[model samples]
Target chain A: MHRQFSLQPFSRHYSHSTHPFLDFLDFDGSEPTSAGEPSAAAHIVVRPAERAQLLDVLAAYKDAQNAGTLLTLTFVTVNDYLWLLRAVSQELSQLGRSCLYYLAAAVSDFFLPRQRMSEHKIQSGKGSLHIEMDQVPKILKPLVAEWTREGYIVSFKLETDEALLVPKARQALARYGHQVVIGNDLHRRKFEVVFVSPKASAPRADQGESVPGEHYEESWLRIDLEQHPQKEIEEDIVSELVKRHQAWIAAASAASA
Target chain B: MHRQFSLQPFSRHYSHSTHPFLDFLDFDGSEPTSAGEPSAAAHIVVRPAERAQLLDVLAAYKDAQNAGTLLTLTFVTVNDYLWLLRAVSQELSQLGRSCLYYLAAAVSDFFLPRQRMSEHKIQSGKGSLHIEMDQVPKILKPLVAEWTREGYIVSFKLETDEALLVPKARQALARYGHQVVIGNDLHRRKFEVVFVSPKASAPRADQGESVPGEHYEESWLRIDLEQHPQKEIEEDIVSELVKRHQAWIAAASAASA
Candidate 1:
């Protein structure tokens, strides 16, 4: 069944406090000297007021540039993000089975349709403001079936309620026919995540023999903060995904042979 | 008549692209070497992923720290900004006529009340989402009457429609009994601003003799970008406000004597 969806574009004034990527970097409050100095080398401090400058700095960083480790692009609205994602995915699809799509960013679930939006600022004289937004269309279906069918797709499901994680992840996999869904509870996300995927022996949904809960498998990955105070949970998650992708590639090659 | 107001707190993920402050800074696409090097000294570059680090860098900047020019604070929600504004104004009130409040930030007009918020993410299974928000309270009333009665208060009115600028600004001054309301159209904000204030010889609103259009005056400030490309409109705005503030302080001193 085809579904009609709506999305509202939300924008905010830039303030450094809400930056998402910088949240991962650890910094000491001490001052650093010149760029080549030992103190400066130990800590990298940047104060980009907007995204363009931030991307520019990241693109120019000596370590990242030498390693060819970072590539950056920015989008303003929901539609901008969607278009960029589709274009990038299509380009990556050229790699076929080697490409692994790691979908992480939390795209807004709802948006205000352009037709309903006011041209001027909504004035406060109206006592109260009522806004009816439409649901942002689910794009995972197209990403899996059309954009990159041979690529291994791993999507993320973050939930405030812990109980919803596994079920939501499973539902996403079934609905989109994606390879895996990494489910994480909001509070416990830093320390734990569960990977939900179709079980190796289970019948595929396309075969019309698949059962709901019985056809899926859940593998939990966790880290001990006490033992490894400095370790990131992403390290473990990425390592596991790398192994899975390798196996998938090997199986595809063997089946073709 | 007592008016009810509603405010919604809107938040966004940090993407350098939407930063408001950085929009003012000029950057050429060039790399910098060491801090003491002439090339590095010529241009300042910062890549702050979030607000905290950005503030930290600003606080630590040598020029600002030595000049005692910059003080920064960040607020996450509308309520937080309101509370902070109130507390700061109350403290500044002690300065009496010497204090000047330059109210600029484009505060959100509508906000969802805590009681109406959903605990979990709004599922997209529902076809559309409907939200009714309350108009944010007009804090200027209390700010002028109570927070700092003797202080010079300058509020701002920004409108997409040019015709509404003067009327809206005049209405604000009459309603709040403040000293000035700087009105500017969104498109021409950077190039021009209209300072709307009560006429010097007009009867005060407190005297109950004030008329709407007759009692008020407007002084337009404009900067020709082609003639003076390097000049900022704020330079003129501040210089004018400083002169007026000196006159206000002198008048109060003479009256008290």
Candidate 2:
């Protein structure tokens, strides 16, 4: 997301008050000073324990870079996002690799036509502003069916009210015929999410019977971090996804064999 | 505005990778440290020049606190805001103090009826979700006329399109019968604004003439930040506002005299 949306690197504007830590780590990206000294590095003070932890992080970052593990791609506008999907579709076809589409962008539901948009800034002389916008095309259906049919798709449904959360998520899952719909409330999105799957409610899954449904059985990967305040929900979500992907790969290999 | 509407302070969630600053600042609002150290002093570090600048800030902060020059009332919800305005109204009547209302909050245009809102979190089981919201009452109109009457009201007009900016600002100014309407486009809000006043276009104040009709007496407050890349636009904006406020105060005094 930073690759496409942000003008400056996220780290650059992390915080004015917090730059001392970055400077202490020798990762401050500020330009060279007139004195030719590392920008305020001599002034950075930290405890031995803190220094050691930062060093560990720097080492891990360098290791990841050396291992060619990072992919840098950014899209700034809606058009850029559309173009990125097309590019990814072509690349995935060439590589013959199944992908996981984790959709988490805050997409606008409606938009004004680009051509009709004023070239210059809008003047405030008009009495009350009334905008006419057309609903944006729901692209997830085409993406699921045409672009990445073999891939697993996890879509997020974030609603302001708790009442809308589950229903909208189920609707998304049913509409797109996707693998998972993670429902989250806008107020508590960071800590709680309900993973909805179509096959989870099937009675025979508990009996270890093959359910007559989609190739992959539906299930909800429910993780609540409310009790464990220190734990990150993403850690559990990522681990569960990795396991699911491995299982899918192993099952496909067994079927072919 | 987080003091009014946000669940958490913005700085708390600022860094995705580093929570060290929050830890150091003890702004994580977690348990007290064993050492009982003052978080601000210990965590702060700066270069020689920056240290001098910080000293100046500290001096000013101390002066303000010593002089009892700060009002630290905090509101955390919509109801809180409403109550605060009511309290202020009563206080203003007793004190008979004029005000400069600078409204900068991102207020929601619509809200679900409180009585109809779901008591529990919305469940994801329902197929599709539909939401019906009602327009929020236009509180600013009453605020301008009844609550903060005899005060100079400066309202902000933010628009996405550049072309609609000036027109919308003028419209707001005319509709509200306010002193100043500061117009900004979302795309370039940080650096530029068009300050629209009904008096600006009025036949030259220098000429001591009165002009009829309001076409547009707009003044653009543009900070060409290219030269001084590190300069904040707020610094310029605040300085300009100070002059305008001084002028307003002087005019009020002279008119009474």
Candidate 3:
């Protein structure tokens, strides 16, 4: 039996002696090792050594199988990969079951990098790993497109290329078939943006074209999926996908019907 | 040519773009029905479709060859899978290069029930996939251990049996020889924890006692990395690992000396 838990700030967590989380990042590299391998990098570090210790801790916890004792900490890069005109999509994306990839955490397309990691240390004799950098791709693009391709019916993010914002976003859906292309302004924040379905259209609401057009704007809003943990965002996304998929299904069905 | 775009929501992402990510999670079922094919589970549905797209985008961006545009996004997760962890260590195991695997993004340890996928609409009238999740070895443990096993120092994470208040945070260094441990409380809205290192018995900075002592009462103060991203909480995390690594190097140098 395996249990999952995360340590939150202002929180108290426990580990068993026989649990699975048997290791911590060791700042000290005193552990034994074979020759020819390189030394660990300085940027990413964990502490402690005996992974088996943590593993034993987790193993025991799993045996006990207590959900209350099970907690988790997930991370996300905020605003650094803002390639959109709004932020709502990000809120939604962040709301679902998420994990973060730190190594790939992209710097914002037009943002600043203060070298915060080594700002002070750079001047010290300790040495530094500084280098000039350039803007990387908006991180959301890969996630959005990949999720869509997996038939997860997740959302694709679009930071409107000011020159080709709508066109590019719309094409993403057209090309990737993203369930909803969340288009946001590069400058806007706090979840303001248009949620676009892949067909270059918006989800139809019987409210009779609230704006005389199918695409209705839902201003920046936060999606609290975790607050209502019992509620399934996965299904919500799936239901939405199925609804949108019906059109494709219908067109496909009709063509053969 | 290899662009690391976000995986679009499952269904919509695939609606239009044939060029879009197909199945970030497709790594599964399709792994191999081939004769003697290795096994796979198509669950981690993040960027399956964009795997190739990522290559394309990366190629374009790396060479500055793309005339149209380039998009990038990054996601990270931690696991103890030996092979995967080893791969991570292999990928970013550079000298003075710290590999930070931010624990963000969602890739569950489950796959949807195939019946749910096949008879989804017919059985429920609403097509839905029931994901059966199980625990897999973490993605980070293996790498850190491998780094150590390979003679390279590496850091790791410990999602404790308890996340909030960890008594083990302090002793982590001495027990495991960790340079530092970034204690994270999962419940905290943002990452909140202490960068714990083995303070020397004499209370030397970064090399003091392994377990968090009374001095840490003041250590739990509110400090934001953004405001001051410099003061490496895990400041010695890298250094500690490096020291051991350097020691080995020094040992080698002495032999050469």
Candidate 4:
């Protein structure tokens, strides 16, 4: 079975598991059966703080599913999103090369830790306010190296400057040694995107090889909004990733054999 | 004719006017008709930044009104809210003692001014991010003394510490020389609120008199959720405020005569 995990702060919620293979497979107490076509199942887990709201969301998801449309909703803080990402990646590692991860959420780069946050609202009696926030740990590094070694992980790089898109995407891929980095400019994101990944012969950092700028490949994807106003760029993006993921799975299987 | 102006940073779109008495009354190109019962008209003006979305909201508001419900939506920055408040208050001042300003929105105390804001997104390469924000100007002072001299203004003070409610509310009244300050604790806001105002026969600071701690009166309003789960505390708050506003109007008329 194909498992998907999606996490977003203050909006979407999906589960991250720390269980073994059997426990993961038996999430809904159903045995896996081989079928001609691949089927996907998504699980959503919410924090204990919002348990009451979680129940309401669960009921709503159930109603939507009954009507043939799958839907889930929950809210999370930045800390919760990080925790869930780590936990979910470790659990999905059990699937080995069969997994494909698409990370599209706009996660905040900096956040005030719980200990440093003010208990009461900051009084305006002070003339000015100064705040210091720590950078959120880059979780993709551990996700690629330790959490899910064989999985096809895709991360996004969003930039306001158009010139920085390709370079930033390459930097992310080099830093984290991930499968793909999709770069999009803030204003032009709707119609265009660039996918940056390593060339076939390029060595991965995790494999003890230093990857350079020449070893990376960039592919641009564009859709004409005037030609097809109803079309979404996500369709092209998903199709491209699916093809790459299948090749990855085949390469992993062949190496194992 | 009664005119109401509401301003919120985001989610609520409202208009603030800088027009004269005649221009304010002729907002919709309609002449004012003398009606026995007080009729209220609300105008929503959006900033030029969201002019496109404003049209959509206006259309939505029209649809909702046609269906027997009034609804409006728009988003604004802290700066927009302050500007709208000042402009709207100036226009409403033409109504003299008939105007009542209810300031319930939870405006941020600090904000990064546009001139100091970064042109691009702050990079995470820096270990920690330090941001300094200027204190948002306290607009209530101008709204009371300069914008609307005879208007009955009610401001809100929300505090985490319950003990600070009455004291802070009184301080707001003494500082701004406004008619009322509604104090509510952050946690118990839904069920309880305290109205702090100058007691009858107590001198107001705007009247060249030194108002002391004992001069302010605090009236608490509470609704038990167990007794009436469906009831909202706002209902009681509005009723009390309406009574006080009528008395204020009468007092202003007597002084003018």
Candidate 5:
């Protein structure tokens, strides 16, 4: 069975500046280029190295397609994320495929439900715009318990303060019992992430000695791309994840045999 | 005095899909192109017609810049809109510029105070992320009355519900005593807008005949760009606003003379 896991970026906008793949598209040249109905300056000018890199990428894509590998890309908007997640879970279960859900979208913590929202635009002439939004029901618990069980799951914990990253990540791991929780700081998220897993051994051996089988595991993955800014952290992240998944698959097969 | 007015697009992300002049940069093509460090398949591929359109844009930009015209591009982020507005007001006042403030940004109604936020990431194990944001203090009053008094301020009223557009727009015009308020629905904002002002006559004769001086002055502008989707609504907006401002200037000059 195809690993049945896919990587999807769920955010308000389909294309963003920080997206690893799209980041390459943010060209800095004297001219701009347009594909159809050119409105803006559509001139494409790139340095030699950048052109070579793009050609390499196109070649790789061609190779993958020719090999008959499926590349499924799904775009999720903020308004539809909750409903879409449930639907995806049900679909994956029916197909008997283990899924890996990567939660990376910056969702609104609270929102004005459709029914409570004003029928017309709120008037600014009244002086101040006082909007009281209801807290969105927490979706993680239900997501873990009800959908995509027997599948691996990965979620992100992002905070402005670096000190709170590990503690919060571990807490999420314990609470959700998911496969992995990546903890990162907002400012440094692009460069670093600490993977938290329940199966990992405690960094400090003596700390969890009396806690029965409860041992928090943490693995730090950092990439300094100062010299090579074009290099992405995803390269390392994907490689590490693949290794872990392969090991897990081997162990499962051995047990079954 | 350079008409001393500026149109600011206030949103979390400054450069978006709709800033009229910025629209020229939104090109369409099969492949993406990067100026440097191309990561994904960013090849600049476009048809011959698109190339001609881009050259036209470059020529226009060169002409404007060579003519010694000042085209200020002020980008304001979510956290900085208020401060930037104040700063712009002071700058224009000092220069004795008659400014036109066109406020058309999707601003957040509430925000978490910096002091109240957690030093580190909030732990997820505690269950449920409850964020209590304080209502943003209304700054439009001081903006009009104190900061930019000699300027012509035209604000925008965007509502999701069509019914609330006109009432709210008129209320803002009366309440603030500003020059004008353009009312638009979120979905059709690009193509349709109702300009509400104290000077203009009622749209239809009998609609406001009963009211003594309470006659509503509203002008509906709707452009159907079905065949020419690339055509922007801002072109008309700028032209109309320029006509009104010129008349205002002539009146001011006659009074002094």
Candidate 6:
């Protein structure tokens, strides 16, 4: 008998006036302003710290998902983003498909708190973190297993706390049955990346044949879905879901033993 | 001087995709249910042609103006329910201490296309009209006069017919000195409304009270302005604008004047 990951759904309801702490925004991908002026708030919000932020991001993502966006979900707070990663994984598992997706939580942990954040000058202490990271739900593991059980495919993210990214990715494949796991150095706003898949052991494979990830239109997706009438956007989301499911089913069955 | 309504000042771009149509949906608000039937949708959609059913009622009370709503404006369209009037005049004009609370149009003549409309059980003849009814822009006259030239406030809705609402509204009041004209009706879903203003109105004395007119929610006014972020079922449009502009206006000036 195969074991599985069980996920419980949670929603954070904010009061009329208060906002969740975890709702702070991220400066990454944001255009910085000229010196000696207030920072421009173009995609620049504080990282979210409370439960409400998670719900807000979830609501935004849900609205987008329902509206047919294939974009990866983005958030400000490291903790909430991590939590969301697990949530998405658990949701996928509950639907009888395991997720093999990457979540770089330790990434945000490196950033200093907002009160201590200074853009111009780097913080001095050059201190190393002796972090006591608690156990996060390894949603990716169970998700990938669930997908395998139902004959599906999935992928995830990884950042090196270990010696080699390739070995780490292979270990993940052996344990969770993920076809691929993207590994990285966990730095901010950089373009360098690495992809690790079960097929990585085969060099003669169609390694260069991988297509680039498609990017989403920021301004278009940046809308407050609640502000627009329901039809056009809603129909778009439905069409995207159907398309993805059909493609995923085809790809997984053909590749599976 | 043989003058017309003052032209509205051009301003920054505005996006007003009022979600009220979606939010107030009873898609199946009422469950015309049968045994073992599925739940009716919580949304309601009415089409452009069907709006004639609602307009028939509003035209009945056109002359009776002072509905005495405690609220300031009338966010009403023709045949709007008695509860949602927004005394639009109250926001732009006043005689020192009195508010000319009335409504103007930023309303839609054509509504969302409908699927099924109710059959008319009228005890009348070809009471049906192939109505090419151009929705008259409500309150275009007075709102444009005082607010536009001196401190204008008026509104209008334009079609490919651009709007005759403002000019017609101004002529109705025997003055064109309004500051703003809300122009909109078709060709755009949101942000189509423009605030147009015309010159001042000549002062009148010995004003007499007019009989009461029925009122309702100005879905049309809310369409371009309040429809953004979404439409609230309980909010009155006139009072909302007053809070934004500090005018001590009447509840319905034209009816009582």
Best by lDDT: 1
TM-score of each: 0.77, 0.58, 0.26, 0.74, 0.68, 0.24
Fnat for each model: 0.55, 0.07, 0.00, 0.54, 0.15, 0.00
Docking class of 4: incorrect
Candidate number with greatest TM-score: 1
- List model 3 lDDT by residue over A1-257, tens digit each: 01112222111122211111112222234432354222332111223343333333333343334345533323333332243312323444553422212121222333224553342212111222233333433444455444222232434343434444454445544444334554555554232445555223554222222323234223233335447644533344435445555665456557777
Residue A47 lDDT in model 2?
49
TM-score of chain B of each: 0.75, 0.72, 0.35, 0.72, 0.71, 0.28
Off by over 4 Å in 4: A1-64, A67-73, A207-210, B1-73, B207-210
Superposed by TM-score, candidate 5 places the C-alpha of residue B7 at a distance from the truth, in angstroms, of 14
Pull out the clashing pairs in model 4.
Answer: B14-B45, B15-B45
Compose the digit string of candidate 6's lDDT tens values, residues B1-257: 00111111110010011111111111234564463232333222333433332223222222122243222122233434112222333433344333332333333333212232323211112222221233333333433434322332434434444444334333333333333334454554253343333222323211211211111012234354554555431244445455534532332344468
Is 4 or 6 the stronger prediction by lDDT? 4
Best by DockQ: 1
Give RMSD (Å) of candidate 1 vs. truth. Answer: 9.4
**Native-to-model Cα distance after best TM-score fit, residue B231 in candidate 3, in Å:** 12
Superposed Cα deviation of residue B112, candidate 5 (Å)? 4.3
DockQ: the better of candidates 3 and 4: 4
Misplaced by over 4 Å in model 2 are A2-80, A93-98, A106-141, A156-227, B2-99, B105-140, B157-178, B183-233, B254-257
Q: Is candidate 3 or candidate 5 better by lDDT?
A: 5
Model 5 lDDT, full chain set: 0.59
Q: What TM-score does candidate 2 reach?
A: 0.58
All DockQ scores: 0.33, 0.09, 0.02, 0.21, 0.19, 0.01
- The segments of candidate 3 whose C-alpha lies over 4 angstroms from its true place after superposition are A1-257, B1-85, B91-132, B139-141, B147-165, B168-178, B186-191, B198-221, B224-257
| Model 1 lDDT tens row, B154-253 | 8899999999999888888878888989899999988999999998876666643245698899999999988998687988998999998899899888
Question: Alpha-carbon interface RMSD of model 3?
Answer: 26.4
lDDT (10s digit) by residue, model 3, range B15-110: 212322211212234454354222332122224334443433333333332253322233333232334445555756664333333332434333
